[model samples]
Target: MTKKVLITGFTGQVGSQLADFLLDQTDYEVVGMMRWQEPMDNLYDLTGRINNKERVSVFYADLNDFSAIARMLEEVRPDFIYHLAAQSYPKTSFNIPIETLQTNIIGTANLLEGIRQLKEKNGFDPVVHVCSSSEVYGRAKPGEVLNEDTKFHGASPYSISKIGTDYLGQFYGEAYGIKTFVTRMGTHSGPKRSDVFFESTVAKQIALIEAGFQEPIIKVGNLSSVRTFQDARDAVRAYYLLSQESYKGNVPCGETFNIAGEDAYKLPEVIDLLLSFSSRHDIKVETDSERLRPIDADYQMFDNTKIKSFIDWEPEIPTSKMFKDLLDHWRDEIKKGKVPLNR
Candidate 1:
C-alpha cells in the first residue's frame, strides 16, 4: 500500500503549496486536515483531484477539538504528518490574544497528545514535522542572527503562542519518543501571500493601484525592520526533505532547524522592489498607524546553516520572482472580480 501523508492547514498558502509539491513529486496519498468551513481559496486548483480522491482527500478535523483530531488520526494513521495549522497572523493576534494563544498553543498540544496515545497503542510511528515560526525569536537584538539555540523572546501574543507550540513539539518527541522535528522558517512569501503581511500588502496595493481600484498611495505601517525572505515553495521543499530524513531515522526526535533565505533587506527596500514591478510608476508610500502592531518582530535575520547541513537545500527562488508572482496573483484575483479589501 502507498504510504499516506497528513498535512494540517492544507487550505492555507504554505499548506496548499506543500500539497501541490507532494502531488507533483511523490506517490503518497495526501490527506489534508482542515476545519469545516475553512476558506478553500488556496486549494481551488486541486479541487478536481481532491473530489476524485486521486491521491488526495480532505478530513474535517479542528486542532482545538481533541476528539475530532484523535478520530482523524485513528482513521488516517498517516505515515507522515506535517503540522502547519495555527492562528498565523501576528497583528491579528494582538486583538484576539486569548483566542490566538488557545488555538496555537493548546491546539498543538491536542495534536501531539493524539500522536502519543496512538503511538503507544498501535506502534504508529509517523515522521512528524511540527511547523514553528521565526517569529518566536521576536524582538531580536540588532545584528543578531537567530539559530536553533537562541533564547526566545516573544514579541507578540502570536509569538508567545508559537513559543509554546515550539516547546510542545520538542516536549512530545522527547517525553513520548515520537519521531518529530521542529522548523523555524523565516518570513516566506510568493503567490497567495495574504494581504495582512507587510510584503504582500504592498504588492496587493500596487496591483490595486495598477488596476485603478485604489489611489497610487501605498498604505503601510512600521518599515524599520530588517529581515530575510524566502519562497514558500522552497520552504516546503525543505520540509519534505526533513520528513524523509526523519523517516530514515537520521534526524533526532525534536531536533530544531532554522530554514530561511540568505538575502536580507530593509522593509522600505521591499516596497521599492515591488513597486519596480508595477505598471504605474507614480505610486507613493504613506504611513498608516492602524497597520502598525502593538509590538513587532523588528529583526529576523536567521542562521540556516543547520538545515543546509542536514538537507541539500538553499533557497532557489529569487526574491524578485516571488514579489512579481505575488503582485500578479493579486492582479489575477482582481481580474476575477475578487477584489481584496484594503487593510
Candidate 2:
C-alpha cells in the first residue's frame, strides 16, 4: 500500500517543492491543504504552468479551524504530517501580530490537538514535521552560529509565533506521544520563490533591468546585514528525511534541527554575485529603507551537523548556483511578460 502523507501549505515555496519531491520519487500519496487558491496537480504549476494532473491531489481548507482540521485528519489518517503553513514575514508580522499569532500558534495547536485526539481513539500516531524559521532565534550573539541549543530571543511577532509553535510541537510530542520534529531554517531561495524575499528582490530587479522593464538602477536595503541562504529544494529534502526518520522511530523525537548552508553571506556579496550573473556588474545599486527589516540580526548561520548526521544529507546546490538560478528564472518570467517592473 502506498503511504499517505498530508502536507499543509502545499502551494508555498518549500511545501510545494516537498510535495513534488515526495510524489515523484516515493510511494507516498500526497494530500495537500490549499488555503487560499485551488491547489495544482503537480510541480509544473509551481513553475507557472500545469503539466501533470495525476501526480498530486489537493483539498481546500483553512488551518485555523481545529474541527475542520480534525475531520481532515480523521479522513486522511496520514502516516506523516508536514505542517508548513504560517503568516511568514518579519516586517509584516509587526503590522498583523494578532493574525500571525493566531495562524502560527493557534493553527499549530489545532493540528496537534486533532492529531493527538485521533491517535487516542484510532491508535494511529503519525509523525509530524513542523517548518520553523531561524528568525525564531531573533538576535544572535556575535560569532555564535544558531544551533538547536541556542536560546531564542524572539524579538519580532513572527519569531514569537514560531517559538510558540516550536514549543507547542514539543509539548504535544512529550504529552501525547506524537512524534514531532522541527526544522528551524534560514533563508532559502530558488527559481520559483516570491520576489518578496531579499534574494528574489535582487533577482527581480535584475530581471526587470535585463528585460528593459525598468531602469538599470537596482534598489537594495541593509546591504551590510549578513544571512545564510540555502536552496529551497535542499531544505525540503532535509525536512522529508527528518520527518521520515522520526516517524520510523529511528531518531530522537521532540527535537529541533537547524538547516542552512555552510557559510553566511553578506548582503553586498550576494548582490555582487547576482550582478555578475546578469553581466551587469557596473549597474548602480541604491538603498531603499522600505526594504529594511525592523530588527536585524548581526549575523545568522545554522549549525546543520545534527541534521546532517541524522539524515545523511548535505546541501547539493551551492548558494551561488541558487542565486544564478533565481536570476535566470526571473529573467525568463520578465521576457514572457509575467513579471512587472515594480512588484
Give the winner by TM-score.
1
- What is candidate 2's CA lDDT for residue 36? 52
What TM-score would each prediction reach against the true structure? 0.99, 0.93
How well is each residue in 214-320 modelled by candidate 1, as lDDT tens digits? 99999999999999999999999999999999999999999999999889999999998998887787889999999999888889999988998899998999989
How many residue pairs clash in all the candidates, one count each?
Answer: 0, 0
Worst-scoring 10-residue span by lDDT in model 1: 274-283
lDDT of 2 by residue, 260-322 (tens): 877578888888889888766557889888877788765787788788888889889988889
lDDT of each: 0.93, 0.82
Clashing pairs in 2: none
Cα misplacement distance, residue 171 of candidate 1 (Å): 0.6
Q: Which stretches of candidate 1 lie over 4 Å from their true place?
A: none
